[model samples]
Every structure is written in structure tokens, then in C-alpha cells.
Target: MNDVIIRTEGLQKHYVLGAETVRAVRGVDLTIHSGEFVAIMGPSGSGKSTFMNMIGCLDTPTAGKYWLDGQLVSTLSEDELARVRNQAIGFVFQTFNLLPRATALHNVELPLIYAGVGGKERRERATEKLRLVGLADRMDHKPPEMSGGQRQRVAVARALVNEPALLLADEPTGNLDSTTSEEIMVQLRALNEAGQTIVIVTHERDIAEVARRQVHLRDGLIERDFLNSTVETTV
Candidate 1:
């Protein structure tokens, strides 16, 4: 059976700036199955970010439909979308959005805190996720104390601590150097191997190459959607 984790039909987002209409995303129909690692690639103004916002439940579409894990989220209220985002989506960003003063473990525990998880359980779960990202020894270290790669790993751990069904990474390697970028991609590959669904948005072909499938967008439409038969299967 094909377990579709994300499905969108006629998804569109438009905005008006003093009579100038901006069609950010126009009629994007997409499907992402469970455990698949996919990348959404596009140049600036190509609407990839708008498309990502729609699927990530961070923005509402002006028109169209969206289904996430079989739930119709397109028409959901803001509060409902918030609930779904917290329970089903994990977000990794270009910047390692960590609290400057908090330790790595505490930073990872933020999601659980928002979910109202108990202290002991939250600590244990955050610890496990940090360890999964190879940051076991840096639990007590603050973000400033870690290297660029290590801080991003901490961000990844925070994203996974909630055990979200879909992981949305937006320009995850944008800030890292070539070597550190590869390190992050390798970690993402391992997470996919362990059955986490991921969708990354990036303009860099090299970063997108790490994903098994690539979807190219242009002018708010999908230009190509194909499997990367030659994508490296191992880190």
C-alpha cells in the first residue's frame, strides 16, 4: 500500500500589494509518501517557499485543498492548523534556531514543553533525540559553545524530539560550509533510513542531490518530478 503522508490539489496562494497581485503558488498538486526523502528545488521567486508554507501548515492557501496524513488541513482554522503542525510536522530551518542561553538538551526539550509533556519524560525523550543526532556529549553545552555543524545537529534533534510524521527542512544547509553541509545531509540520510519522512527545500543542486527524489518548480508550477536513480544510497 502507498502511504501518502502529504497530498495537495489545486493548491494556490495569492497576495495583493496595492492592486498588484502576486500569485505565489498556483495550482500545485503534489503527493509525498511515507519514508521518502524528497527535495523541492527552485530559483528565487519560483514559489517553492510558498508551496512549502502551504504543505507545512504554516500558511493558508487562498484557494485549493491540502491533505496531511489524510486530514483535510486546507480549510482548517488557525488553531486547528497549529495543533496539526505541532503534532505532525517537524521543521528544520537554514538557521540553527536555538536559544542562546539554553543547553542543547533544554533546547531540544522546548517542543515537548509546548506539548505539555512531563519534565522527566521530556528530559528522557530529548536526551534520546540528541543522542540520535550524535550530540550525547554536548547535552549541557550551549549553542555558542558548539561548532556550526554541531549546532545544526542540535536543531535536528529538536525537530525530531516530537517524533513528527513529516519533517520539513527549509534550506537546511544554507548556512554551513561544504564539508558541514555534507555532514548534515549524511545525518538526514540516516534519519530517512530509519523511516522518517523528509521534504527539503533548497536551490542548491548538490544539496538536493542527497534526496532520492527531486521536484523542480518554476513560475509557481512543477517543472519536473522524478526519482534520482543515481542518488547516493549511502552516506
Candidate 2:
């Protein structure tokens, strides 16, 4: 099996703003292997968000090459990128981006539904994901009926329903309390132990401490990339 999940070479992004050009990502060369959990850490305007967008397939790099799950993604057309995003990447946003009115199971099933999965398989996958995330009993509950943590768990379930190659989370704990954030982190760590390749993008140093590896970004370039020797190994 291919071990490299993500690889980038000379990745750069620029925005033209009314005569003044903005350099979002200067030049980043990164490689993330399978079954590895990593944190993309950076502060505001550090190019973390732009880098996340490129890696997530939500935006294309202005100058560079990107490979996702062994495919050349930097040059893929929009339609192709969309396909890659749906099949190879799963995203969990900070706001617990779950459908307010849909049941947890239904919300988790949205991706499969979009992928044209049959109703039976969709339900089965969604149920399994919810169960994996410790929300088996809350499958029928809507986002409004659950606490912030539970809702985020549902979002995690939804992201996993597709069995993505990479689980990408953006400031996942931004909306949760300390206790709840730890709960979610424990759940994520469990998933990582199960061989899932996960990447978390965040500005919070504490939150990044859980990852085994961290890539620090500054001014659109990687400032430091190293194994996190001080990772909190306890739940």
C-alpha cells in the first residue's frame, strides 16, 4: 500500500487585491505519511488557513505541485478536485458543522448520499461511524438536542462515514470547553491508534500538543517541522 498520504513541492499561493498582491503561502514542501497524526500549527495570517485550504483540496496552489493519496492534485480540474475532496478527504470544522434539523445519523449520511451510496449502505456506514465516535445512542438526536461536544462528535462521525484517506480538522476544539475538548481529543487519538491518518489545523498550542508530529508555519513558510517529543500520551 502507498504510505504517503500527502506530498507537496514548492507550494505557493498569492492573492491579487486591488494592485497590492498578498502572499498567503510562500513556499511549503511537506510530506505526510499514512497512519500519521499531524498538527499544522500557526497563528493568524501565518498562512495556516491558506495551506489548509490547499491541502484540503478547497483551493489550488498558485505555484507548486500537490499530491493527495498518490494522485497529482495540484493540477486537477475543479471537477476532479471535487471528486478527490469527496472521496479522499474528510473535514471537521470548528463550528460543529452539522445540519441543525437532521438527525445525527442523517447528518452523518450526507456525504455518502452525495456520493450516490444506496440508502441501506449509507445508513449502515453512518451508524457504524456514530458508534465508533461513541454516539451510538444519540444517532436519532438532532444537533440542537445535543451538547457542543456531542454535536462535534456527530460531525466527526459524518467526516468518517466516507472512510476518507485523511481526516482534516480545523480548530476542532475552538467551540468546546476544556473537558469537552479533551473528550474529543481522546476520541481522535483512538481513531489515530486505529490507523487513521489525521491532520489538525489550529492556532492553539495546547491542542497541538496531542499530535505526534507538528508542522509550524510562519509567514507562509514552514518554520519548524519535528516529532513532538512532549506529546501528552494520557487520556
Candidate 3:
């Protein structure tokens, strides 16, 4: 009743890999409230990635229930899930995931294009988002023309273009250096301070510390859930 943005009850996912049934997620029960910044931390093969895929609506749960923004996501069909993903969530990947040939502005506009937004509106909104991420001057540059941090900033801008209820970042700083990672964290902290609900997945404790709460996953089950002590001081 506390304005939950995401809720999952007994969520589960299983994968068959080479005659072995891998239980990626086993009964994950979670509640993420609006405007909360949460991090998911786990070792490799601990099922955090699978959990993120389920939360982002990129993959279906093998069983159990998931609700996003008061709607039953686990009950939705593939097409319906796609619609929900476009409307309710934004994704930031470990890699920048920008097209090499596309300009930064065009890369940021990709989501708008899929959503069928008008070209003029897309350009205006993309520009505003890029400016917000401190990439206004590099709108015309391609991925190869930008540094790793700059490319990631473009990806962040793209994610924000939809203004979705949830921002999902999966190892967003994995590809960056330590300095750049801190810079990206600074930006994310600022966004969270501005009331963006964020769910970040990372293996690094330093990175996970940026969030207000942390959920630890092990062997496809939640091992720990606690409030993070390192709150943003400057943001």
C-alpha cells in the first residue's frame, strides 16, 4: 500500500542447459516502492541477471507472480509484455549498446522511434535528455568518436528518454575505469535524488553501495536484504 512500483511473489525462472535443469531464480519475493533506489548484488551464476531480466520484462518467469506499476506482468502475453516494457521501464546495459554508425542524438532517439513518437518531438526530447546527461555538445558524435564514459552517458540519456517509472541498470559501470565509474555513479545519484526509481544490478560492492538498499542473491535465491549505509552526501 506504500505506492509499490514493483512487486513479485514467489517468482521463479528455470533454464535447460545441456540436459541440466538450471534453476536461475527460485521464489523471489520482492517489493520496490516508487522513488526508491535499490541494488541487486550477486556472484556470477547467482541468478541476479535472470532476476533483472524478469524485472525488466525482457523474459518471462517460469512460474509465480510479478506486478509492475499495479499491473500483473507475469500474466501478460509476450506482446503485452513488450508494451509494458516500453511504457513502464527503461534499461541501461553494461555496454553502451549504441549503434556504431548512429549519432549520439539518433541513438538516444531509438526508443522514441520504437514508441512511434514524432520525429520533431523525438529530436527535441533526445536533445533535452542528452543535455541532462552532459552530452549536449556531442549529440552529433558517433560511439567511436566518444570515450567510454561519454558513450555510457549517451546510453543513460537514451534510457531516460521514455521517462519510465523504473530505471534498470545492469552492471552499468562494468566497462568503465574506476574514475569513469565514479562519474557515472554521481550521475545516477543525481537522477535518484530527482525522484527516479532505480534498480541496479552489480557484482561490485563499491558500485552497489551507491543505492539506498541492497539485495543479495546466491544460488538463485535471495540471501540478504538490507539498507545500504553509504548514502549520497553531495547529491
The lDDT per prediction is: 0.93, 0.93, 0.93
- Quote the positional error of residue 32 for candidate 1 in Å: 0.5
Writing each residue's lDDT as its tens digit, candidate 3 over 1-235 gives: 2589999999999999999999999999999999899999999999999999999999999999999989989978999988888878988999989999999999999989989999999999999999999999999999999999999999999999999999999999999999999999999999998999999999999888889999999998999999977586532
**Runs of candidate 3 exceeding 4 Å displacement:** 232-235
Better of 2 and 3 by TM-score: 2
Model 1: worst 10 consecutive residues (lDDT sum): 226-235
Candidate 2 residue pairs that clash = none
Native-to-model Cα distance after best TM-score fit, residue 108 in candidate 1, in Å:
0.5
After best superposition, candidate 1 residue 206: deviation in angstroms? 1.1
Off by over 4 Å in 1: 233-235
Worst 10 residues of 2 by lDDT: 226-235
Per-prediction TM-score to the true structure, in the order listed: 0.97, 0.97, 0.96
lDDT of 2 by residue, 153-183 (tens): 9999988989999999999999999999999
Rate residue 221 of model 2 by lDDT: 98
lDDT of 1 at 233: 52
